[model samples]
Target: MKLVVQEFLTLDGVSQGPGAPDEDTSDGFTRGGWFVPFVDEEFMEIVDGWLAQADGLLLGRRTYENFARDWPAMTDHPNGAIMNGLPKYVATQSLTEAHWDPTTILAGNIVAEVDALKRQPGRELQIHGSARLAQSLLAAGLVDQLRLAIAPVVVGRGRRLFPEGSTPAGLRPVSQHTTKAGLSVHVFDTAGLPSYGIYEG
Candidate 1:
Protein backbone atom coordinates (compact mmCIF):
# COMPACT_ATOMS: atom_id res chain seq x y z
CA MET A 1 0.00 0.00 0.00
CA LYS A 2 1.29 3.42 -0.89
CA LEU A 3 1.07 6.06 1.87
CA VAL A 4 -0.31 9.35 0.61
CA VAL A 5 -0.83 12.57 2.56
CA GLN A 6 -3.63 14.92 1.54
CA GLU A 7 -3.78 18.27 3.27
CA PHE A 8 -5.29 21.74 3.03
CA LEU A 9 -2.99 24.59 3.88
CA THR A 10 -2.90 28.34 4.05
CA LEU A 11 -0.48 30.40 1.98
CA ASP A 12 1.87 30.26 4.96
CA GLY A 13 1.59 26.45 5.18
CA VAL A 14 -0.76 26.45 8.16
CA SER A 15 -2.79 23.25 8.29
CA GLN A 16 -4.11 23.56 11.81
CA GLY A 17 -7.83 24.06 11.25
CA PRO A 18 -9.38 24.34 7.79
CA GLY A 19 -12.76 22.78 8.43
CA ALA A 20 -14.52 24.62 11.24
CA PRO A 21 -14.00 27.32 13.82
CA ASP A 22 -13.64 24.80 16.63
CA GLU A 23 -12.00 22.12 14.53
CA ASP A 24 -8.62 22.59 16.14
CA THR A 25 -8.00 25.47 18.52
CA SER A 26 -4.97 23.93 20.14
CA ASP A 27 -2.37 26.45 21.32
CA GLY A 28 -4.86 29.28 20.94
CA PHE A 29 -5.05 28.99 17.16
CA THR A 30 -7.77 31.47 16.27
CA ARG A 31 -7.49 31.22 12.50
CA GLY A 32 -9.60 28.14 11.92
CA GLY A 33 -11.73 27.56 8.81
CA TRP A 34 -9.35 29.46 6.61
CA PHE A 35 -10.03 27.15 3.69
CA VAL A 36 -13.81 27.48 3.71
CA PRO A 37 -13.87 30.31 1.20
CA PHE A 38 -12.01 28.25 -1.36
CA VAL A 39 -14.59 25.50 -1.60
CA ASP A 40 -16.00 24.84 -5.04
CA GLU A 41 -16.89 22.08 -7.47
CA GLU A 42 -13.33 21.77 -8.66
CA PHE A 43 -12.05 21.45 -5.12
CA MET A 44 -14.69 18.86 -4.27
CA GLU A 45 -13.88 16.89 -7.40
CA ILE A 46 -10.22 16.80 -6.55
CA VAL A 47 -10.89 15.80 -2.95
CA ASP A 48 -13.43 13.19 -3.99
CA GLY A 49 -10.91 11.65 -6.34
CA TRP A 50 -8.40 11.30 -3.53
CA LEU A 51 -10.91 9.82 -1.09
CA ALA A 52 -12.13 7.40 -3.72
CA GLN A 53 -8.69 5.84 -3.88
CA ALA A 54 -8.23 5.48 -0.14
CA ASP A 55 -7.96 1.91 1.08
CA GLY A 56 -7.41 2.95 4.69
CA LEU A 57 -6.62 5.93 6.85
CA LEU A 58 -3.55 6.66 8.96
CA LEU A 59 -4.45 9.31 11.52
CA GLY A 60 -3.23 10.97 14.67
CA ARG A 61 -5.26 10.87 17.88
CA ARG A 62 -6.74 14.33 17.53
CA THR A 63 -7.81 13.87 13.91
CA TYR A 64 -9.11 10.39 14.62
CA GLU A 65 -11.28 11.57 17.49
CA ASN A 66 -12.53 14.54 15.52
CA PHE A 67 -13.46 12.47 12.47
CA ALA A 68 -14.87 9.61 14.53
CA ARG A 69 -17.22 12.07 16.16
CA ASP A 70 -18.29 14.01 13.10
CA TRP A 71 -17.95 11.88 9.97
CA PRO A 72 -19.98 8.96 11.22
CA ALA A 73 -22.97 11.24 11.65
CA MET A 74 -22.62 13.00 8.33
CA THR A 75 -24.36 10.54 6.09
CA ASP A 76 -25.40 13.34 3.78
CA HIS A 77 -21.87 14.45 3.09
CA PRO A 78 -20.31 13.44 -0.21
CA ASN A 79 -17.36 11.68 1.36
CA GLY A 80 -18.96 10.71 4.65
CA ALA A 81 -19.66 7.14 3.67
CA ILE A 82 -16.10 6.44 2.66
CA MET A 83 -14.70 8.30 5.66
CA ASN A 84 -16.89 6.33 8.06
CA GLY A 85 -16.34 2.93 6.50
CA LEU A 86 -12.63 2.83 5.67
CA PRO A 87 -10.23 1.12 8.09
CA LYS A 88 -8.48 3.65 10.32
CA TYR A 89 -5.07 3.13 11.85
CA VAL A 90 -4.45 5.64 14.61
CA ALA A 91 -1.12 6.46 16.24
CA THR A 92 -1.67 6.96 19.92
CA GLN A 93 -0.78 5.60 23.36
CA SER A 94 -3.49 7.29 25.41
CA LEU A 95 -6.58 6.15 23.53
CA THR A 96 -7.84 3.10 25.37
CA GLU A 97 -11.18 2.70 23.69
CA ALA A 98 -11.67 3.86 20.13
CA HIS A 99 -15.43 4.27 19.76
CA TRP A 100 -15.10 4.24 16.01
CA ASP A 101 -15.48 0.86 14.43
CA PRO A 102 -12.61 -0.71 12.50
CA THR A 103 -9.95 1.36 14.25
CA THR A 104 -6.51 -0.05 15.01
CA ILE A 105 -4.24 1.75 17.46
CA LEU A 106 -0.55 1.88 16.71
CA ALA A 107 1.00 2.22 20.17
CA GLY A 108 4.73 1.62 19.90
CA ASN A 109 7.17 2.73 17.23
CA ILE A 110 4.83 4.50 14.84
CA VAL A 111 7.36 4.59 12.04
CA ALA A 112 7.79 0.82 12.15
CA GLU A 113 4.05 0.25 12.37
CA VAL A 114 3.39 2.52 9.40
CA ASP A 115 6.22 0.88 7.52
CA ALA A 116 4.44 -2.40 7.99
CA LEU A 117 1.19 -0.87 6.80
CA LYS A 118 2.87 0.34 3.63
CA ARG A 119 3.99 -3.20 2.88
CA GLN A 120 0.42 -4.44 3.03
CA PRO A 121 -1.58 -5.03 -0.17
CA GLY A 122 -4.00 -2.19 -0.72
CA ARG A 123 -4.80 0.75 -2.95
CA GLU A 124 -3.57 3.64 -0.84
CA LEU A 125 -3.26 4.26 2.87
CA GLN A 126 -4.25 7.89 3.07
CA ILE A 127 -3.42 10.45 5.73
CA HIS A 128 -5.77 13.39 6.06
CA GLY A 129 -5.38 16.14 8.69
CA SER A 130 -2.90 14.36 10.97
CA ALA A 131 -0.21 17.01 11.00
CA ARG A 132 1.93 15.42 13.71
CA LEU A 133 1.62 11.97 12.21
CA ALA A 134 2.41 13.38 8.77
CA GLN A 135 5.58 14.98 10.14
CA SER A 136 6.68 11.72 11.66
CA LEU A 137 6.07 9.87 8.40
CA LEU A 138 7.89 12.55 6.46
CA ALA A 139 10.90 12.35 8.79
CA ALA A 140 10.97 8.58 8.33
CA GLY A 141 10.57 8.97 4.56
CA LEU A 142 7.43 6.86 4.65
CA VAL A 143 5.17 9.16 2.68
CA ASP A 144 5.17 8.35 -1.03
CA GLN A 145 3.09 11.21 -2.34
CA LEU A 146 1.68 14.47 -1.05
CA ARG A 147 -1.40 16.31 -2.34
CA LEU A 148 -1.74 19.83 -1.04
CA ALA A 149 -4.56 22.32 -1.60
CA ILE A 150 -2.98 25.65 -0.80
CA ALA A 151 -5.45 28.39 -0.07
CA PRO A 152 -4.58 32.01 -0.73
CA VAL A 153 -4.69 33.09 2.87
CA VAL A 154 -2.05 33.64 5.51
CA VAL A 155 -2.94 32.79 9.09
CA GLY A 156 0.29 34.20 10.58
CA ARG A 157 0.44 31.50 13.28
CA GLY A 158 -0.83 27.95 13.52
CA ARG A 159 0.36 24.37 13.27
CA ARG A 160 2.13 24.38 9.92
CA LEU A 161 2.64 21.36 7.69
CA PHE A 162 6.30 22.09 7.18
CA PRO A 163 7.64 23.59 10.39
CA GLU A 164 11.12 24.66 11.38
CA GLY A 165 13.66 21.86 11.98
CA SER A 166 11.70 19.44 9.81
CA THR A 167 13.77 16.93 7.90
CA PRO A 168 14.71 18.38 4.53
CA ALA A 169 13.63 16.27 1.56
CA GLY A 170 13.50 16.59 -2.20
CA LEU A 171 10.05 16.59 -3.78
CA ARG A 172 9.04 16.50 -7.44
CA PRO A 173 5.73 17.91 -8.48
CA VAL A 174 3.84 15.25 -10.41
CA SER A 175 0.81 17.37 -11.11
CA GLN A 176 -0.64 20.79 -10.35
CA HIS A 177 -3.87 22.66 -10.97
CA THR A 178 -5.47 25.90 -9.91
CA THR A 179 -9.05 25.94 -8.75
CA LYS A 180 -11.53 28.62 -9.76
CA ALA A 181 -11.40 29.90 -6.20
CA GLY A 182 -7.66 30.52 -6.49
CA LEU A 183 -6.59 27.40 -4.57
CA SER A 184 -3.48 25.73 -5.90
CA VAL A 185 -3.76 21.98 -5.88
CA HIS A 186 -0.47 20.20 -6.24
CA VAL A 187 0.61 16.56 -6.11
CA PHE A 188 4.24 15.88 -5.37
CA ASP A 189 6.25 12.68 -5.28
CA THR A 190 8.85 12.29 -2.57
CA ALA A 191 12.25 12.35 -4.23
CA GLY A 192 14.41 11.07 -1.38
CA LEU A 193 16.74 13.18 0.82
CA PRO A 194 17.54 16.75 -0.12
CA SER A 195 20.85 17.70 -1.63
CA TYR A 196 22.73 20.89 -0.94
CA GLY A 197 24.77 23.07 -3.26
CA ILE A 198 25.94 26.66 -3.34
CA TYR A 199 25.47 28.73 -6.46
CA GLU A 200 28.26 31.15 -7.33
CA GLY A 201 27.18 33.98 -9.57
Candidate 2:
Protein backbone atom coordinates (compact mmCIF):
# COMPACT_ATOMS: atom_id res chain seq x y z
CA MET A 1 0.00 0.00 0.00
CA LYS A 2 1.27 3.48 -0.89
CA LEU A 3 0.90 6.41 1.49
CA VAL A 4 -0.43 9.47 -0.31
CA VAL A 5 -0.42 12.65 1.72
CA GLN A 6 -2.73 15.52 0.76
CA GLU A 7 -3.17 19.01 2.16
CA PHE A 8 -4.89 22.31 1.40
CA LEU A 9 -2.55 25.13 2.26
CA THR A 10 -2.35 28.87 1.82
CA LEU A 11 0.34 30.45 -0.35
CA ASP A 12 2.15 31.42 2.84
CA GLY A 13 2.18 27.73 3.91
CA VAL A 14 -0.39 27.98 6.68
CA SER A 15 -2.22 24.64 7.11
CA GLN A 16 -3.58 25.14 10.56
CA GLY A 17 -7.33 25.53 11.15
CA PRO A 18 -8.49 25.56 7.55
CA GLY A 19 -11.96 24.58 8.67
CA ALA A 20 -12.76 26.69 11.69
CA PRO A 21 -11.83 30.05 13.17
CA ASP A 22 -11.79 28.77 16.75
CA GLU A 23 -10.55 25.24 16.02
CA ASP A 24 -6.87 25.98 16.72
CA THR A 25 -5.85 29.34 18.08
CA SER A 26 -2.57 28.29 19.60
CA ASP A 27 -0.54 31.07 17.92
CA GLY A 28 -3.18 33.81 17.90
CA PHE A 29 -4.32 32.63 14.49
CA THR A 30 -7.50 34.52 13.76
CA ARG A 31 -7.70 33.73 10.06
CA GLY A 32 -9.25 30.29 9.92
CA GLY A 33 -11.54 28.78 7.28
CA TRP A 34 -9.68 30.72 4.62
CA PHE A 35 -10.05 27.90 2.17
CA VAL A 36 -13.84 27.81 2.39
CA PRO A 37 -14.64 30.55 -0.11
CA PHE A 38 -12.31 29.07 -2.68
CA VAL A 39 -13.96 25.67 -2.77
CA ASP A 40 -15.55 25.68 -6.20
CA GLU A 41 -17.11 22.69 -7.89
CA GLU A 42 -13.92 22.13 -9.87
CA PHE A 43 -11.97 21.94 -6.64
CA MET A 44 -14.54 19.72 -5.02
CA GLU A 45 -14.37 17.42 -8.03
CA ILE A 46 -10.65 17.05 -7.56
CA VAL A 47 -11.09 16.39 -3.83
CA ASP A 48 -13.87 13.89 -4.45
CA GLY A 49 -11.72 12.05 -6.97
CA TRP A 50 -8.90 11.70 -4.49
CA LEU A 51 -11.18 10.67 -1.64
CA ALA A 52 -12.65 8.00 -3.87
CA GLN A 53 -9.30 6.33 -4.43
CA ALA A 54 -8.50 5.80 -0.77
CA ASP A 55 -8.15 2.34 0.72
CA GLY A 56 -7.99 3.78 4.20
CA LEU A 57 -7.58 7.11 5.94
CA LEU A 58 -4.73 8.16 8.25
CA LEU A 59 -5.32 11.14 10.53
CA GLY A 60 -3.78 12.99 13.41
CA ARG A 61 -5.79 13.43 16.60
CA ARG A 62 -7.11 16.94 15.93
CA THR A 63 -7.96 16.22 12.30
CA TYR A 64 -9.58 12.96 13.39
CA GLU A 65 -11.85 14.81 15.77
CA ASN A 66 -12.76 17.34 13.06
CA PHE A 67 -13.50 14.68 10.49
CA ALA A 68 -15.39 12.51 12.92
CA ARG A 69 -17.81 15.33 13.67
CA ASP A 70 -18.17 16.57 10.09
CA TRP A 71 -17.78 13.94 7.35
CA PRO A 72 -20.72 11.81 8.46
CA ALA A 73 -22.94 14.88 8.31
CA MET A 74 -21.70 16.21 4.98
CA THR A 75 -23.52 15.78 1.72
CA ASP A 76 -23.77 12.21 0.49
CA HIS A 77 -21.65 11.08 -2.40
CA PRO A 78 -20.97 7.53 -3.46
CA ASN A 79 -17.29 8.03 -2.67
CA GLY A 80 -17.66 10.37 0.33
CA ALA A 81 -20.21 7.99 1.78
CA ILE A 82 -17.72 5.13 1.48
CA MET A 83 -14.99 7.18 3.13
CA ASN A 84 -17.16 7.80 6.17
CA GLY A 85 -17.64 4.05 6.46
CA LEU A 86 -13.98 3.01 6.09
CA PRO A 87 -11.60 2.41 8.96
CA LYS A 88 -9.56 5.43 10.05
CA TYR A 89 -6.22 5.19 11.83
CA VAL A 90 -5.54 8.06 14.19
CA ALA A 91 -2.00 8.79 15.38
CA THR A 92 -2.46 9.80 18.96
CA GLN A 93 -0.74 9.18 22.28
CA SER A 94 -3.58 10.39 24.50
CA LEU A 95 -6.54 8.66 22.93
CA THR A 96 -7.41 5.33 24.50
CA GLU A 97 -11.00 5.02 23.38
CA ALA A 98 -12.47 6.47 20.21
CA HIS A 99 -15.68 8.45 20.25
CA TRP A 100 -16.34 7.86 16.57
CA ASP A 101 -17.17 4.58 14.90
CA PRO A 102 -14.53 2.65 12.91
CA THR A 103 -11.62 4.47 14.50
CA THR A 104 -8.35 3.00 15.83
CA ILE A 105 -5.62 4.58 17.92
CA LEU A 106 -2.10 3.72 16.80
CA ALA A 107 -0.57 1.75 19.70
CA GLY A 108 2.99 1.13 18.59
CA ASN A 109 5.62 3.49 17.25
CA ILE A 110 4.30 5.79 14.53
CA VAL A 111 6.86 4.76 11.95
CA ALA A 112 6.46 1.07 12.67
CA GLU A 113 2.68 1.18 12.50
CA VAL A 114 2.68 3.16 9.27
CA ASP A 115 5.30 0.82 7.82
CA ALA A 116 3.02 -2.12 8.61
CA LEU A 117 0.17 -0.31 6.93
CA LYS A 118 2.31 0.32 3.83
CA ARG A 119 3.21 -3.37 3.65
CA GLN A 120 -0.38 -4.50 3.67
CA PRO A 121 -1.92 -5.50 0.34
CA GLY A 122 -4.56 -2.96 -0.32
CA ARG A 123 -5.37 0.28 -2.13
CA GLU A 124 -3.56 3.54 -1.49
CA LEU A 125 -3.63 4.69 2.11
CA GLN A 126 -4.62 8.35 2.01
CA ILE A 127 -3.77 11.12 4.49
CA HIS A 128 -5.41 14.52 4.67
CA GLY A 129 -4.77 17.65 6.76
CA SER A 130 -2.46 15.87 9.19
CA ALA A 131 0.45 18.28 9.02
CA ARG A 132 2.27 17.04 12.14
CA LEU A 133 1.72 13.42 11.23
CA ALA A 134 2.83 14.10 7.66
CA GLN A 135 5.99 15.75 8.97
CA SER A 136 6.90 12.63 10.91
CA LEU A 137 6.04 10.35 8.01
CA LEU A 138 8.00 12.48 5.56
CA ALA A 139 11.02 12.60 7.85
CA ALA A 140 10.92 8.82 8.12
CA GLY A 141 10.79 8.51 4.28
CA LEU A 142 7.43 6.77 4.32
CA VAL A 143 5.27 9.11 2.23
CA ASP A 144 4.95 7.90 -1.37
CA GLN A 145 3.35 10.96 -2.93
CA LEU A 146 2.20 14.45 -2.05
CA ARG A 147 -0.89 16.23 -3.38
CA LEU A 148 -0.80 19.84 -2.32
CA ALA A 149 -3.49 22.39 -3.14
CA ILE A 150 -1.79 25.71 -2.71
CA ALA A 151 -4.41 28.36 -2.07
CA PRO A 152 -3.97 31.89 -3.43
CA VAL A 153 -3.72 34.13 -0.37
CA VAL A 154 -0.85 34.20 2.07
CA VAL A 155 -1.32 34.29 5.84
CA GLY A 156 2.23 35.65 6.47
CA ARG A 157 2.71 33.56 9.65
CA GLY A 158 1.40 30.34 11.12
CA ARG A 159 2.48 26.74 11.67
CA ARG A 160 4.62 25.45 8.86
CA LEU A 161 4.27 22.10 7.16
CA PHE A 162 7.91 21.07 7.43
CA PRO A 163 9.51 21.84 10.76
CA GLU A 164 13.22 21.95 11.57
CA GLY A 165 15.41 18.88 12.24
CA SER A 166 14.94 16.41 9.40
CA THR A 167 17.05 14.92 6.64
CA PRO A 168 16.52 16.31 3.15
CA ALA A 169 15.11 14.30 0.27
CA GLY A 170 14.62 14.96 -3.44
CA LEU A 171 11.15 15.53 -4.85
CA ARG A 172 10.13 15.15 -8.49
CA PRO A 173 7.07 16.93 -9.79
CA VAL A 174 4.96 14.29 -11.47
CA SER A 175 1.90 16.37 -12.31
CA GLN A 176 0.34 19.80 -11.93
CA HIS A 177 -3.08 21.40 -12.29
CA THR A 178 -4.68 24.75 -11.65
CA THR A 179 -7.94 25.59 -9.95
CA LYS A 180 -10.37 28.34 -10.85
CA ALA A 181 -9.02 30.54 -8.07
CA GLY A 182 -5.42 30.09 -9.26
CA LEU A 183 -4.52 27.43 -6.70
CA SER A 184 -1.85 25.09 -7.96
CA VAL A 185 -2.30 21.42 -7.32
CA HIS A 186 1.19 20.00 -7.47
CA VAL A 187 1.76 16.29 -7.25
CA PHE A 188 5.24 15.18 -6.34
CA ASP A 189 6.68 11.70 -5.95
CA THR A 190 9.83 10.81 -4.07
CA ALA A 191 12.61 10.43 -6.60
CA GLY A 192 16.36 10.90 -7.22
CA LEU A 193 19.18 11.27 -4.71
CA PRO A 194 18.55 12.51 -1.17
CA SER A 195 21.31 15.12 -1.08
CA TYR A 196 21.79 18.87 -1.01
CA GLY A 197 22.38 20.08 -4.55
CA ILE A 198 24.03 23.34 -3.54
CA TYR A 199 27.39 23.68 -1.80
CA GLU A 200 30.02 26.38 -1.38
CA GLY A 201 32.32 26.41 -4.33
Which lDDT tens digits does candidate 2 get at residues 1-201? 899999889988888877778877877988888777788888888988887788899999888988887777775755657777888999999888887678889967999999999999888888989899998888788999989998888877778786466557679999899988677899999764466667779
Best by TM-score: 1
lDDT of 1 by residue, 33-127 (tens): 99999999988998898989999999999999998988889999978878889999999999988889889999999999999999999999999
Each prediction's Cα RMSD?
1.1, 2.3
lDDT measured at residue 165 in model 1 versus the true structure, 0 to 100: 91
Q: lDDT of each structure? A: 0.93, 0.84
Cα lDDT over the full model 2: 0.84
- Give the runs in model 2 whose Cα sits over 4 Å from its true position: 75-79, 192-201
